[model samples]
Target chain A: MMTLDQDSIHKHSFNITNLEEIPGKKIKHHYGLVSGSVVRSRNIFADWAAGFKSIIGGELPMYTRLLNTTRNEAIQRMIAQAEFMGANAVTNIRFSTSDVAQGAAEIYVYGTAVFVE
Target chain B: MNGLVTAYLQNHELVVGSALLIVGYIVGTLFQRNHLRSIQEREAFFFKLPAVTMKLKSFVPESHWDQIESARMVVGSVVITPDYFRYFLSGIFDVLGGKVKSYESIVDRARREAILRMKESAPMADIIVNTRLQLDTMQPSIPNMPIRPLAVYAYGTAIRLKKSSFPQSSEEAIRFPDQDIIL
Candidate 1:
């Protein structure tokens, strides 16, 4: 029968001796991973709707653009964190949302970190 | 005098009635055009799904995250291109003319965002098993138009396994050539 260990990556180890010295070795590697999320206040997103109603009229285009930009920024931040850890890969990635207030929304990013070797 | 007065009044009424009718027609046509435009835009936005999916996948691992063994749930989201709003309006025009095909940029943006988020949350694990894709629309408030954002997430139970239980092909293990002792 298949055991839990059979399904785990822990069972494997990579040999990095042949490869050039990676920068991460000098710095203390974080035992766990890091993550980033971009969140917006509901009121903030609502401004787009109000803007559409009064100015452009029908379908707020500005807000969509804003959110897109924010999300990208958040993602970039997360990647930077992983790179700093000297990790080539990450696992168990997940996202979550929370209502910060009546007019606010929060986006959350979470993941796991591992050392390849 | 009575007959002449009646005729004058009839003529005035006819002119006013005709004018109102013409105005009504113009207003009706304008409203119809606006409605049509909105519908076209909606269609364009929805049609962009495939490209968005493809673009988002590029940033995320095409295969499952290999580090996790089991998972209960997974969820993620990414904002489309910054110009996603422009496209929403342009898509409306495109739907009518059949010319709305620039979804690659948006898709790429989404993929990158999702992967970045994934990286942030799950940096140390070797693999993230059993990933799923989720799409959503973000509208901050009733006053704001909803922006379509997509996310790719891979979730599984994170575990530590000894070298014997893991798969270590030369190609996959080459990244860590220094840790040859365990092998």
Candidate 2:
């Protein structure tokens, strides 16, 4: 079981933004696009609860949380990759999701790693 | 008396099915009404903060370029499931081969809610640019589930500008739904 330390993972010291350029900073080096992905599935209990909730037409909190955590983990991995490339910050970040299998959801995030000053 | 009992027993499934449908219709309608009302109220509140799909350079004038102080990524996501009543109606419509009106409203509501949430996350930002929305249908492991839950995810770069030149309400920023209905 992989523990999800979302808050701790986000504490990584790297400037991450989804803009063409970081504000008030100049891009000195472009390390190319860095990407990360995660595939996740919910347990039987959560699936059962969501099935019941769907009948009444409402928000499914369990699934929402599952996807949220998955996305955060994927972003963390992307940042780690950028850090490996000796980049100080990442720009133009984007996220995408796809259904890989019957029970699994894949979250993919990508961004350009750059040395900004 | 014996014939009457037999007849009731034979039609018990139909009676129960109709009862369930009636309950689902009433509850689903009430929930949709309340949710739409809440969305309307929040939309009015966030009207001042515009989130557009265009890039920052094109959307904001060149003069405002130097006014931008900082930018950050903001995201909003929601997962909504269709009611049993709608699900049942769509199933029949599937056989008839036509538009599934019930599902359309479900998708619309989720999209609007996701955008509203993105706006709520960045209350201090002057505007959000490069806005994008992703819609996905979650396929659960549960077997025999007729309707899959829909997830709407929205994200954008929220840019903060120097407050001195900030326009409280810009005409260009308010383009959504009915473009002419200005608040």
Q: Could you say which candidate leads in lDDT?
A: 2
- The segments of candidate 2 whose C-alpha lies over 4 angstroms from its true place after superposition are A1-13, B1-16, B61-64, B164-183
lDDT of 2 at A48: 91
Q: Which 10 consecutive residues of model 1 chain B have the lowest summed lDDT?
A: B48-57
**CAPRI quality of model 1:** incorrect
Write candidate 1's Cα lDDT for B104-136 as tens digits. 433444444443333223323333333444544
lDDT of 2 by residue, B78-143 (tens): 889988889889989989999998888889999998888777656556788899999999999988
Each candidate: chain B TM-score: 0.37, 0.80
Total clashes in model 1, counting residue pairs 3 or more apart in sequence or in different chains? 47
B157, model 2: CA deviation in Å? 0.5
Model 1, position B120, has a per-residue lDDT of 27
